[model samples]
Target: MEKKSMKGYIYLMPALIVILLFTAYPLIRAFLMSFYEDYNMISGEYSRIGLGNYKDLFGDKDFTKALRNTSIYVVFVVPCSIALSLLIAVLLNSNIKCQGLFQTIFFLPYVTSVIAIGLVWSWIFNSNYGLLNIILSWFGIDKVQWLNKPKYALPSLIIFSVWKSMAFDILIFLAGLQTIPKDLYNASRVDSTPRWRVFWKITVPGIAPMISYAFIMGFISAFKVYNEVFSLWGGKAGPANSAITVVYYIYDKFYNSHNYGLASAAAVILFLIILVLTIVQRMMGRKK
Candidate 1:
């Protein structure tokens, strides 16, 4: 048995070493470097700054905005996407005609390139010539700025995010729904259970695990949003930094400003947030 275990470990050695060399080493190095002042990205020289980097982040307005905007994005996007996807999954699971075609259409956004998604949506969201405003024009209402105004920028992001993120969750929910024994649903119908009760008591519990997984993954994705904003806003955040997120904060500090120490500190903070949230998600899943 021990020899067999040894052979198994040897089989895993290459992958384990790759993970250690890339992920673990960089993580440890960044954590240690976070205590120093901005390390010269070019020359690799820095001074010990203690908690100066973190302190600066707390005092910085853009950093605070990034945190708030990320929180708002996660809070709105995660649940809304999950709920919408769940509804779609249920509908698709029913005895509807052309389900395959409908499913493919819905899942296309998830498989499409992020750059393409952003570009296509940009035209639709254009303040002046966009189809959205064109439709509003028919109603005698003035065009509402979508991406170019701080007031509407975040919501525009949320809409685009939900549209994209819902596809994967829908697929997961559909798979989970299939795993549930059809006899249970049939029995509920035979007993004359109301539609809502059948859904709550049977369907909801049946898909609870899928919902848990979706929520956890969705929350993580939503919290770390960057590429969406970057692509949509052409490498900048939305108007007035409305779509700025913590990852983007780190990107600006490390890549743009060359503030390595502050970026590392921010990365550590992000890691902690994700770790805590994942743990909480696991606890809730176990409780349920």
Candidate 2:
């Protein structure tokens, strides 16, 4: 038994080493760097500044705006994505012709390159000569500057995000839908229960877990939105910084401004926020 246990431990060592090298080391280094005041580009030295870096982050206006924008994006995107996904999943789950083709078309966005999608979507949302504005012209609506205007930019990004993410949620919910026994629906029909009542009572409860999973995933992803905004707004974070997200703020600090310590502090704060929210979600899920 002792020999067998030793062999098993030896087999696990490689995986554990990889995890420590890739995950543990960077996290530990970042946590330590957050305590110092340093610029990666200008200075080679990292001087200890205690909690000063974190203190400065709170006073930074850009960081505040980024956080606010991230919160707003999360609020709008999460529920909308989940709801749209659920609806699509339900429709796709029905006995329709060319179901496989429909599933493939819906999921294509999820698998496509983010940069490519952002580029294509940017043109589609262009103020003039864009497909959307062209269609709106038929309704007597004027051109809308989707990316150039502060008010419309973030909402446009959210709309694009919802479209890109809904496919994955649809797949997840479809899996859940399949697990729900067909006998329940048949029995409800036999009992003369209305379709709406059957869905409310049966379908919703049956996919509650999937809905919860999709909500948490969507919320987390929306909070970290950067690439789309960067591509759509030419890396300026949209007009008036309306589309600046927390991750993008961190990127600007570390890469553009060379503020290593402050960037690490911002990253640490973001980590804590995500960690706490995830914990709360898990607790609520357990309670349910």
Give each prediction's root-mean-square deviation over alpha carbons. 1.9, 2.1
Per-residue error for 181 in candidate 1, Å, reads 1.4
Task: Report the C-alpha lDDT of model 1 over 1-288, residue by residue, as the tens digit.
Answer: 344446787889999999999999999978977888757767777876588888998999999999999999999999999999998999899889999999899899898988888887888899899988899899999989998999899998898899999999999999999998999988987999998898899899999999999989998878889888987888889888888899999999888988889899999999999999899898987887
What TM-score does prediction 2 earn? 0.93
Query: Where does candidate 1 stray beyond 4 Å?
Result: 1-10, 285-288
Task: Write model 2 residue lDDT over 79-189, tens digit each, in one string.
Answer: 888888888888888778898998899899898977888888898899987798999999999999998899998889888888888888999999999999999988998
- Which window of ten consecutive residues has the lowest lDDT sum in model 2? 39-48
Candidate 2 clash total?
Answer: 0
Task: Please identify model 2 stretches exceeding 4 Å from their true place.
Answer: 1-10, 39-44, 284-288
TM-scores, one per candidate: 0.93, 0.93
Best-fitting candidate, scored by lDDT? 1
Q: Local error of candidate 2 at 99, Å? A: 1.6
